[model samples]
Target: MFNIAYRMLGSVAEAEDVVQDAFLRWHGADQSKIATPPAWLTKVVTNLCLTRLSSARARREQYVGPWLPEPVPTADGALGPLETVEQRELVSLGVLVVLERLTPPERAVFVLREAFGHQHREIAEILDIDEAHSRQLHSRARRHVADARKRFPADRARHEEIVRRFLDATLRGDVKGLEQFLADDVVSWADGGGKVTAARRPIVGKAKVLRYMLGFQRRPELKEISAEIAEINGQPAWVLSWNHMTAVFVAEMEGERVAALRAILNPDKLRAVTNWRPV
Candidate 1:
């Protein structure tokens, strides 16, 4: 249930609130009146998310800079065991950002169909719409995400190796080494949520990204921070802590090159990862 809410809302704090609210409503309801517990709970949580989405969309619109989904560590199986490439891809920061462009109904339909594996008919029942409408919503959501999606590498060993090399090269400001793993069109986005110093806009292109990496490595502040690797959102990411603030860096891969790099430096978003020990 928390997993469903997390995927729908993209904020751990909000999802926890939704789950608590659902429980309160469930406890007050007439038990005998509820026909199926699972369906009843799902409907309650999903609708709660839909209501939140109306406002969430507005918040993102006014967000200071490039907004990103809160990266949750998958080591605890909190987001469930994402064992398949498709499942991991769906939870990734890049894909979640794309899903943000979707309408509330479209997102709900997509999450139900792809993440939870619900049939069109079941999805319709959950959303309180006809089966045909469910299919339409799912189709639209898929089309919205299809163009931006990048499938996760099928082999875990190779994926880790690439990230390791990239991290090593990046820490040392090795441009040639960085180019080996990054694509020419690679883009980087940092989200500080207006609370800290960060790039106000996306930094695009391999050259610009490498410059940014090199510049960051030369920062006097880097000396105070400790860096370690963690599996976040089902992929390898760097967790850096300095001045009591946590930030994460992850590369969204496309075969041998990195399609994107996400730096989640938002103080609020870093809360979940701050205490997480690497797996």
Candidate 2:
């Protein structure tokens, strides 16, 4: 339950708060009256998450620049036990950006069902809604998310091979090579939240994305930037650093090409990298 809340909220401290609150709510309840403690905990935590999500959406709308999720890196570079390899990749910055298109309730239902494996009945209890309404929301959310995401076969090895090629191309500044691996209409987005410099708009089209990458590589200050491969979301990704500053890049692959690139450079968004050290 703690892991579930932590992943959902992206804050250990906040997850702790939610967990404690849930337990407190159940403290005096009759033990026999609750058939399933886990389900009850999940309900409490998820409802709390929905509340947080609502407030977060309001704050992000007024945010100074592009907004990105708080990155979470484990020792093994994967989301914790609760998440599968596929879910991790599907929840990357690119996917999360698409999720922003859905309404708050839609997002909640999607995450609860698709990401967390909750059934409509479980989700209904969690969100405090009727079963039918939960089913409707889940269906709507799934459709929106499916439309937004590519239909890539779930092949981890293939995904890693593509990512490795991407890293090689990036490190070598092989614009042509990189271009060959990008989709014709590739898009790239950066989120710095105005705390650091980043693209204010999405870089659309393969040609523009190629030019942007080339230009970024040519920056005089970038000569000092160091990069490493790390697990981001659930797939291999690049982590760049200069002095104490850090940035993370995760790619979305389509076939043998890159469909989208997500770069997270905001210092405030790199809190999870605070303890990260260059290799």
Candidate 3:
């Protein structure tokens, strides 16, 4: 349920709240009257998420800067199985951000069909819609995310190696080394949620991104904050903390180069994964 809600809502706090609400509802309901427990609970959670998404979309309209998905720790498989590249991609921050382009129904259908391998008929049941509509929603959602999706390393060891090397290069201000790892049109987004300072807009282009990286590395405040690599959102990411600032850098890969770098600096978003020990 947490996995479904997290993927649906792109929020750890909200997903947890939705699960708790579902539990409360389940506890209050008469089990004897329920036909199927799993299906019943899934429907409840999915509907609850739809309600939240409606309001969340409104709030995000007024959000400061680019609103990125909350990064979650997946090293322990807490959310669900992430054994396949497709599974991990579905839960990635970049893909989640792209999913925001979809309507609530479309997002729900996509997550159910793609992440959970639910047939359109089952998805229709969960969302209280017909099979035809479910198929249409899934098709639309796939089109929206098709261009946004990027390939990433399936091997944890190789992924970690790239992340660590990227971190090392960035910290040392090795522009040449870092440039080699970035895609031609690479972009970076930072989500501080207005609580801390961050780039209000996405930094795009390889050269521009390199300049930003070099400039950010020169900050005196970051000197005391050592970077730690951890498995976040089913991939290795850089977790940096010093005083009140906490940020997670998730690299979206296209083959061997990073296609995008998501910097989640919002204090609220980091709570779930902040305590994660380095992998």
What are the root-mean-square deviations of the candidates from the true structure over C-alphas?
1.6, 3.0, 1.7
Clashing pairs in 2: none
TM-score of 2: 0.85
* lDDT (CA) per prediction: 0.87, 0.73, 0.89
Off by over 4 Å in 2: 6-35, 74-78, 82-85, 151-153, 276-279
Per-residue CA lDDT of model 1 for 1-279, tens digit only, reads 898998898898899999999999999999899989988998899999999999998888899988899989997887998888888878888778888889999999999899998898888888999999999999999998885565477787788888888888877878789878779999999999999888989999988988888899888878887887778988888888887778899888888998889999887887678757531
Instruction: Arrange candidates by TM-score, descending.
Output: 1, 3, 2
Which candidate comes out best when scored by lDDT? 3
Among all windows of 10 consecutive residues in model 2, the one with the lowest summed lDDT is 74-83
Per-residue C-alpha lDDT of model 3 across residues 89-182, encoded as one tens digit per residue = 7887878988998999999999999998889989999888899999999999999898666566667688789889999999999988999999
Better of 1 and 3 by TM-score: 1
**Error in Å for residue 58 of model 1:** 1.1
TM-score, one value per model: 0.96, 0.85, 0.95
